[model samples]
Target: MSDPLVIAVDSSTSATKAVVVDKSGQVLSTGKADIDLLTPGMDMYEHDPVQWWESTETAISQACAALSDADRQRIKALCITHQRESFALVDEDGGALRPAILWLDSRAGDEIKEYGSDHIHELSGKPADTTPALYKIAWLKKHEPEVLTSAHKLVDVHAYLAHHLVGRWVSAVGSADTLNLLDIANVDYSDELLDIAGVTREQMAELAQSASIIDTIKKELTDSWGIPGDVVLVAGVGDGQAAGLGTSAIDEDVAYVNIG
Candidate 1:
């Protein structure tokens, strides 16, 4: 029997990348596409969600196309790792309500202050900043009321991709935890937060375990992208989580930092 094939998807502020590997972690194929980050002024950064999606799709398709049929069929699972905190609002029809506010965007700094620095820090385990979803959502509602009112769901980078791949809106615990909408203690959605964001349970995606199988590749997506029918789609964790796993940083004291 051949080794099980694995694929890893990394979507971040700057780019989306996909890599195909065997059970032994030997890379077979890799592809990447960069998404342009727009900065209209100081403390304002954004990206077109449609472009991001297109880039991700192109990267994954290219990676799969680079592989031989037998290798593709052996694909056992696909994992994803995405940048934390960036968010996009989508309408009921799955169209983006507006451009995604990236993690680095700081136009919401004052809005974050309204939530109180200490309260946010205690609840989120991170200092309240422009990077947190809470502030971004608040900023959107205030500045772009029309867009916010029409939005049917607020999603992070990975959730958006998962929806496209699996035909369901699902979010990962790791990513959700960074959203400021989930309680850090219980790791579940916070009602107070949903109320603050003007969203309800029905407007949110279901949360899934980071390593659990979220869904198999849908037949239509597989057919369109020429992916094997047996490919498994694993609910990916945040980039930091995936790096910790990849580097065997399993202990609490283990530290891994990225600097660029």
Candidate 2:
């Protein structure tokens, strides 16, 4: 008998990659699809939310097609590891209200400067920077209050993909950490931070720890990919944390140094 299979998807800024792996951690198949990134202004970058989901679907479809029936049937998990800080505001039905702002976007410089403080840095474990999604959310609130206020959920990339895959507005705790939304020391969302970003707890995804099984892939999506609908969707962290986890750095003593 063959080993159980798992499909891991990485939804990145430039592209989405899907890799099928066996229980032994050997990759059986791989697929990738490019994502279109738009820069409307010098410091503003965005990606169509639709393209994020489509790229994921296209990548998975291509990866699964490369597997044999036996290998495919053994699939047990679908996990997603994605970019950090990028976020979108979605309607109740998981539809995007506007293009998702990318992590690289710096249009919220003024907001960052205004809200940037040691207290915020201590609370979020992130200093006011161009990378945190909080600043971008503030920018949205200032320029498009109507749209921002009307959103059913303010979510990061992981939450968006998780909703589309499993029909739940949930995000991996580690993945949402860098959004400048979480009280990292407590591993939970801070009401003060949410208020600062002009978002509410009711408008945020429920948080789950990394690798926890959150939900199952939707039947429609599974049927399209030729995978069983019962396959569990596992929660995953952002690329940085995922890399640390991959390198077996799960504690303070064990560190993952990324030397360029």
* Candidate 2 Cα deviation (angstroms), residue 183: 1.2
lDDT computed for candidate 1: 0.80
Give per-residue CA lDDT, model 1, range 1-260, as digits (tens).
47887878898888899899887788999989999988887888888888767888888888989988877777777878888888888987678987888878888767877874687677667677766778788877788878877788888877888888887888888877777888778788888777776677777788998888888877776666566566777877888778888899889898887675
The parts of candidate 1 lying over 4 Å away from their true place are: none
TM-score of each: 0.93, 0.95
Local distance difference test, per candidate? Answer: 0.80, 0.90
Question: Model 2: per-residue lDDT, tens digit, 1-260?
Answer: 55678999999999999999887778999999999999998999999988889999999999999987777788889888998899988899988898999999999989999999999999999988999999999999899999899999988888999888988999999888879999988899999999988988899999998889998888898788887537898989898877887898998788878653
Best by lDDT: 2
Q: What is the lDDT of residue 236 in candidate 1?
A: 76
